[model samples]
Target: MLSRSRALPAAVLMAALLGLSGCGDDTDEPTTTASDSAGATDSPTASTSPSETAAPSSARTDFCAQIPKPAIRTALYGAAIYDEAWAPGKDADVRGGVHAEGAEFGCAWTAKDGTTVTAWLFAAPVSADEGATLVKKAGAGCEHKKMRAPGADAAVTVQCISDDDTVTRTQALYGDAWLSCSLQTPGILTRLDRAADWCDAVREAALV
Candidate 1:
């Protein structure tokens, strides 16, 4: 079974990643085949087999398997008030495959204290280093900082909708997967730490 992500209200965490995709230029390469050429007049007219078809108009790709439930639970650290997993087909693969803006899978853990932690993996063209660079550059205007975990390429940035405590988000790239960790608590300092912890947990699980 597949499920939708339970994220912070659209006003907060959602906007935090708004500029991430736009930071880099659109590079979706168009897919074409020899029979797609206009000059190919002798191309077969018979309907193409489903397997031979190019990209499907609508299809689903499951990516939730990449995250381990036990790891996610452990990463939450504090009491987990909420947790969920998304099954395959809940979403489509990233554009241009798992290296663009198409595939998405994630799980989240909400603490009893109103602190929320979420992890995400987006298949994109950029390597782990490239993704880190983009996030660092894209978040230049925000309160951002680079973080290094033994086995993960990561960064952390804070964005608060209010003047007080807000959400802290950590991002990392593992292989071709873009991993994200978010924490929202009443204290900014705690949130930041939690976010980092989330990243570290993800790194340990992924690198293992």
Candidate 2:
């Protein structure tokens, strides 16, 4: 049986992907510590305040490093410059649900021309019957098709046009892992082939 708790609805996933945007550099604010205070000296009696405690470490960060830069360039096509838009431990400007769901890893790359590609993997234990059902629901109301890909137990791709942007998305299941990739390009029509490549690359890099 499919775990509804682990399976995200198609709308939630689409909203997460469409809402992605470039994250700007974060500026750190200077802070005054116990030793930095006026007339303060380095004494054993000085104690650190609760607010000065270090933040908890991120759950993960190495997810983005698995995918090579060359694969990203191929996914984005004409984009000359591209940067990592989101990764674990980064700001919540990207897919917060990915972290909320304890995703194995979620990554997004944005180009200077507003083109973006995102890939994520979720560990959902479901049978083949349930996987097919999930895939069908995800590809509803779009140009949906199924295909075979290396390392994937089952795979499907969907292409949809929203307003002035073309969105191509692919989802694949490998045992208990659910992998997905989306490519969104403004004013450009993208095909399922590119989306499939992006999905396959992610599966190869992550499932290994």
Candidate 3:
């Protein structure tokens, strides 16, 4: 089953870069792939198919499992509200289903209450804006205001109210590749604003 769990913090970025490939159904989870100038093998994800998630040989060559530790730490440092970063711990191998040679990267984020949001970065790239549109269509209800970053290969945000007390913000990014972030918590508009602000800051800082 698709985890159905909350996604990470950079989905808007992914949708912008990967196109509409990753959007639509939450059940049919999407993977991410990036092209590095360095000549290295591309790692696979449980959700990536041989055709859909595979980057051209010239685009991405390195296969180390997760984004570099420094990259995640940099993104966390950029976040306005949180001062912590997610470190790459281990590389777990996965096979079958979506693609071959799949792997998972462990990561975490600091919550408002100072608790850590332990998560994983799944390496599977889908179409740009797919995550944001799909999330809005399936998850909490909210109104999309405007495009956050222009000229960005991919960038978008959606605000939704799951209930009277909860608001959610979903953001995605893509430079040479794609990344996504989803914030689902309990609170009114205040929490959503803070989360969106933090995500925007991190996105700016994390860019190469």
RMSD of 3: 11.3
Error of 1 at 35 (Å): 43
- In model 2, what lDDT does residue 123 have? 30
Order of the predicted models by TM-score, top scorer first: 2, 1, 3
Per-residue lDDT of candidate 3, residues 22-80 (tens digit): 22222111111120000001122225322344442211222222334444334333332
* Predicted structure 3: lDDT: 0.32
| lDDT to native, each model | 0.39, 0.45, 0.32
Best by TM-score: 2
Best by lDDT: 2
For residues 1-208, what per-residue lDDT tens digits would candidate 2 score against the true structure?
1001212232333333332222110110001010000001000111211121222121122344677768888987755243432222222322223222222235566566656676665432444564565565554456665644666666777665555555566666676455666666665464567767776676666664
Q: Where does model 1 exceed 4 Å of error?
A: 1-77, 87-102, 128-133, 136-141, 152-156, 159-161, 190-192
Q: What is the lDDT of candidate 1?
A: 0.39
Model 2 lDDT at residue 127: 45
User: Over the stretch 1-208, how does candidate 1's per-residue lDDT look in tens digits?
Assistant: 2232321221222233334221111120112110011000011112311122222222112334445656556554556654453322233232122221122345545556545555554422234445555455444334565555454444445443323335455555444444555554544453345556666665554342
lDDT of 1 at 22: 19
Q: What is the TM-score of each candidate against the true structure?
A: 0.52, 0.59, 0.40
Model 2 CA lDDT for position 153: 67
Q: For each of the candidates, give the backbone clash count.
A: 9, 0, 42
